[model samples]
Target: MDECSATKSTSLETLVIQNISNVKELKSKLSEIIKKGKDYEFDVSSCVKTLIKSNDQEIVFLTVEAISELVKCDEKRRTYSQKEIISPILDILQKEITTENAALIKQCFRALGNLCCDCDSSRKIILECGGVPNIINLMKKYFSAHSQLSMYAFKTLLNFAIGGQEFTNAMVDGGVVEMLQMVVIQELEKEEIDEEAVCALLSLLSLINENDTEILYSDEINAGVLKVLTNTADIDVSELCLDILHAQAEHDSVKTLIAKHGGIQVVCSRIEQLMQKFDHGELDADQSDVEAILKQACDLIVIVLTGDEAMHILYNKGLGEVYISMVKWLEHTNYHLITTGVLAIGNFARQDDYCAQMMDDKIYDKLLDLFDVYVSFGVQMQKEHSVLHPIEPGTITKIQHAILSALRNLTVPVANKRIIAAQGRAAPTLLGALLSVEDHHVAYKLLAAIRMLVDGQESVARLLGRHKSALRCVARWGHAGEYAGAAGEAPRLLAWAVKLLTRGPYWHNIVEVDGCISSLVNMLVASHSLMQNEAILALTLLAIETLKNISPSSEHPEFDYEKSFISQLIKSEIGKHVSILVDTNCAKMPVEVAENLLAFLDITSKKNKLALDYKEAKVTESLKKFAESRQDLSEDLKNCITGVIAAISDNGKD
Candidate 1:
């Protein structure tokens, strides 16, 4: 025998007679045996025999407990052969299935569920031994008087159904649906029944495929489920029903049933009721409860508005009017309600006609006004106490995201661009919020909005250019914030800004490429990894553009900035020091390090113009490569490189 079996045998008598006084001691011994790495079948079989023969109920319970642990071990270790030893224990449980010792039978069924979950053979054995019928009988006998036992049986049945399609089909054939329906109906009639039963039914229905849902619907099993979802007083039951409906919303038949049973309307009503409670301050009774309700409401609205057919139904049913009214009401509340209302309105605005109607009604102005209000609030707080309002971050983030989303739907690019430009330095307020908010989802939304605004005309682009100080602010907050700046999200926003300034028509008219380049190069020189990546990305864009626009001996007076910027970039460690690569912060910097460094280098290089031999070699090498490559070199670039070469050669001659 293996060490596991030896340990099992040594403890068999103690488990069988219930003579062990210390529960912790027994658990410790069993745990040690399990860790011994040995076959425990013989010991399990011996314990099974002793448990069957013993008349002590506690001993029987102890033996079942030991067997359950061994079964779990076997499953984890893939010791399938050892499970056969528990077959006799099933017979003992079968003997205890009568009304008198129903509690004992319930424990045995719990053990069987655990065992079946592990061993396919054990599951089949359970089925062959009439486990389903026994559990069903128990479900009926104790479902009313003994709620705990009924819950046990319900849980066991759920486990059985989980064995696979065969078990699921067997369960359906064995009147499990009828049993569940009866319990659901019974629970509805009573003032109280086990919440566990409701949870079990929901779990069971969730596992069923669409075909099963169809079968259940055809058999009228859905009525009870729908009734509970639509009419129940219990919020938990209603929430579970909504979950079931949402999961099955994709099925045509289920969608029809939901529509027929008023699922959407009921959900909408509940949301409106919650909104009303929120407006009246009644929802402030419990923060957790309010949050849960809000989350459920959002999920339901998203589901209902997801598909075209459902959305059409919602619009035709006047959900749009109700939703717009809600948004109007939410224009002055706390940030949470405002955020939720904004999301709901954004979803509704996805339809072009509906969005046009909203625009016609001046919803965009109201939202922009909310943004102004938040900015004013932030500024006021900063002036009064020399510190910004604590809630200003979240408020700004939500309002910005909402306005951007609404603007995207409005599709009036010129008007939207003007609105974004009007925000001026306040645009950095949203960036500040992105850096400070604990929730990444909010930050992601805010970044998306910033991306849209920055991608517009020259006015908006220039506004961003003036706020170069804001970039370092984001970097600092990201470094000190709890979530490590969410690398994937923040970089996309930064990259989007860089891409826009490089490619957008607004690039030349509004942004000083040199100043932007300096800021980006400084960020690249920082210690943050995300900041460095974005900085390099911006630099790469600049390089690509520089290559495209510069040519040999062809400089225009207006190209002075480009020539001077590229010369400075190439001369400093900003290009050569690989260690300067840090993460992207998408915010302000601590100092104008990149800009100041470039200025310093330009002044010194001109003063020491005749003392730079290596500079000539470097410029000459770059020019030779650019010429030989046969690539389309621009006039400005060629002149820049040639001028650098001439300057260096002149310095070398002195």
Candidate 2:
């Protein structure tokens, strides 16, 4: 045979050896043979088949190693297709997974799992292998033993269900749901069972989607899972249970099961406990524990209230009051607890009545005060933690995000636009915090709040315009290439600011107009894609407004000065900046900018003064091309350009 054939044959023999002392040599040989391409599939398959037949557990374990290597090779080189080995390997794995050798059986499942990473073929293989039965058996027999093989088996089964609905149906049909119910009952019987078992069961349950709610609820699985989620003191297991319940809560039947299983009271009790802890300063104790509980509680509450039925139930049960009370505690001294409380309250305040009531209670003012505290703390913390500057360290950007979100929620337009107006430029502090913080979620939250503020009141627009330097600070650095973590949100915030300036009632004056235009022009020239898009849209809107505001009869003739402004706009550095705005994928330039330009050119044409003292070739060429290109020019555009041509001809006639 050729050298390649000889290498494959040698590697196949090495794969079958029950007592190979040199794992390194076996790995190297397999790597080389698989790298040889499709020809080596038969050799690798034959070796794996032989290893599966061997009774020795060590040899069975060796099959896992070989399969892992093959998978790695397929991933890196794509020289060998997994299709060649999948059927033969699964066939061998099934034959080896008998009850007599459970450990070896578990290892075989793991090997099959390594092959199943292909995702496409895994579901078919899993159903054919009775993967659910094997996984349930392993969960029952070996879950508490800290066996890595057992964990691998359970995890592999999880991958199958997570793949899609068909795989989930397979598990449900195979009684995996009943098995999980038994595990939950067993865990509940003991004051303490292995958290890993509970975690594994929760992971398995999380894979079930809305379609499987009937099967899970009919089997009584939902109630048992909720019991563990609400009652268990073990935070890890409790959190996992919450995750599963959250998924199930989307369905009406499953949500009813959660309520029947005492979920509402349990969740409320947990929130109350957290509040008490915060009130008594116990939140600082075992901070890791506090963080785990708070995060889990927040996630569960958010999920439970997400649906209309669930939210209606929560409101009837006075959960809104509890949320408001928690918002009050958010004003306390512990930054961590305050941050968590703020996040939770922000979500609760999304309800219109809840927000209105919170506003009536002056929650809006209190929430703003909380933001000030957070910023102060962040500054102090920064100083305390900084090695060079010795600056005051505060609650970081994440805390700032929570605080701003709460403020935004409490101070919404329907709730109270006046509070936001009073804050004036101080409101942009949230944007400033966003700039300083590295977290993307925090940055996005702040940007969303800014959008809301700009949407409500025009004074916020004037305030931002007055603070041009601050606006530039965020606009400039937010688009900087090196700054990672949600840099995109900054541009969105700038876009909102631009929208306010152009469309806002108060920012319609000429001075304010120029500032808004300049800010947009700067952002248009920036390198950030998100910022450029937002800037373009904003510039387009401003251009439209600028045209709409212009009239021949205005008391302030600046409104009638469209010709001079248009001339200056096209001639200035900002005019070239328009090219970047036009070329962007965002297509943000105002339709009015084009309309006004056409109007000015048409007037010049009609007045026979189109050639009046033009200096910039680019600008002159741009105008000339617009005149020459006759496609789809609006009536207003045609009339305006005709006016310009007539004016130029009249000048020539004179």
Candidate 3:
């Protein structure tokens, strides 16, 4: 009896029907549900179904508003979308937006906008149901008449666009790009700008451009727009504007215009403000956001700096705090910020005077110090199974490339070269990078920078020769393989090392590296005549140094020819490459190459069995041809060739 006679309570669904059937009662009941949202066990989709059937404006508005409130919860939004609320809600909007039902229309838009915020399916429904042109039209109509309604429209369109390329394209086809430009221009002209409206529109435009890079907004941009974009106090709005401007600046004309409108100064001013906030620890945004703002600012600077007008502006403005900020970013813990800082400063260093100024400020030293950090980090990463603080190896490698690229440009001036080489950090840091960074591009940059650093500076080469691993890396990189430019540059730098160090103890360091001998020999046939000449001379010096080091006497008379440096030199097939160069390009070959080639062959042949190896390589034939064919051959070169032939032929007869 107790089981059959349970306590009576009103079923909420029945109570909902009784209360919500009448229009006035339904409004009040919906308001209560909206107010005490989670307290009610309301069926939102059922209400949506009932409201879609009703023609009464108030009932539809109240129900959709209630649905909007309920769907704000993520789970309910997905449920509502799956229940097919989009087509019905869009139906209500399509019919009522035609009327002057501003209140109902705005409420409907708010509901659709909430649904589309992050719900991809609902967004697809809205797009498929032809909701874009409707929303954009309402946006254009209500932009000035009703600001709130226009904002709702903006939010809805942005949501739809966020669905990705298809939805973004739909909005663009509906002429939303021009409409967004109008909104931005209008906001800029306002006595007090509406930062929210401007931010939303700019964000939508950014999406449009992202989806379709061919769409350019540069023509609509003006001085007022540039001023507002660069001077905004709102961080989000500033970020949006920076993104839009970065896209537009892809066109060179826009870059010139922005720079002419005092773009660099204004942008740098914002960067300086952010930097000030950083220094005081009074951040208006999170740390990453602030750094992102700084990064965007620097990126814009990088692209714009490609223009003459921008460079001129930078030259005049002097980048007071901007320069200081970028230099600070070089030392930041964030590698992205470091890369951006590198790009900006690299662009700045395009001017010789700026390079000198940076050098004076010791900015180059800071870059060198950054390289030193990576060098140590790379070593640690290799030795430890797990690091206490792990960073991606690829990230640091990219930064190395960036830093090397900047250094290459910075060291272009001869005076800067001398100063950088004299600083004593450039040589080791750059050479050490060759071992730490295995990327071919980084190797190329490192080699070029070293080439410039050691162009006229023998001291720098000698300093680099001290890092044995660096020499070994250079030797390996100098081989004829992929990335031939890097290969060529590597030998050029090694040639510098060999030429200058052969007289000193450092020659042993160069000769002992695994591929050093072969790298030098490969250059003898290199297409660059000057490199060939340098190679010949460097090899001759190397041979002289090897013989001097292994010269036999009573004390150390037993020289193991198989284990000697000359043995390794012969194994490189230098005779074969030398024969090819002389036979084909003998007339074009320099007298110095001929002289040094003969000297090198004569020195190597003096060692046991090496002369036989040369004869086996047919070096005797090329040397005899050189002695007979070329009228430009000097008496000294002739004598050298004769001496080498006699040495090899005599050994062959033995």
Judged by TM-score, which candidate is best? 3
Candidate 2 per-residue lDDT, tens place, 225-343, comes to 77676666666676677667666676776665554455766875776677577669865457676666666665666566555555555555334544544565576555455665676
Candidate 3: worst-modelled 10 consecutive residues by lDDT: 1-10
For model 1, residues 430-450, the per-residue Cα lDDT tens digits are: 555543444454455555555
Query: Per-residue error at 562 for model 1, in Å?
Result: 4.9
What TM-score does model 1 achieve against the real structure? 0.52
Question: What's the lDDT for residue 164 in model 1?
Answer: 74
Sorting all predicted structures by TM-score, with the top scorer first, yields 3, 2, 1
Q: Which stretches of candidate 2 lie over 4 Å from their true place?
A: 1-175, 178-200, 206-220, 246-265, 271-290, 303-309, 316-322, 332-336, 381-395, 419-451, 454-462, 468-471, 474-518, 522-654
Worst 10 residues of 2 by lDDT: 608-617
Which lDDT values do the candidates have, in the order given? Answer: 0.54, 0.56, 0.74
- Give the per-residue lDDT digits (tens) of candidate 3, residues 527-615: 87898888888877777766665544343356432355666766788668877888887677777666667777777787666776778
**Winning candidate number (lDDT):** 3
TM-score of each: 0.52, 0.55, 0.67
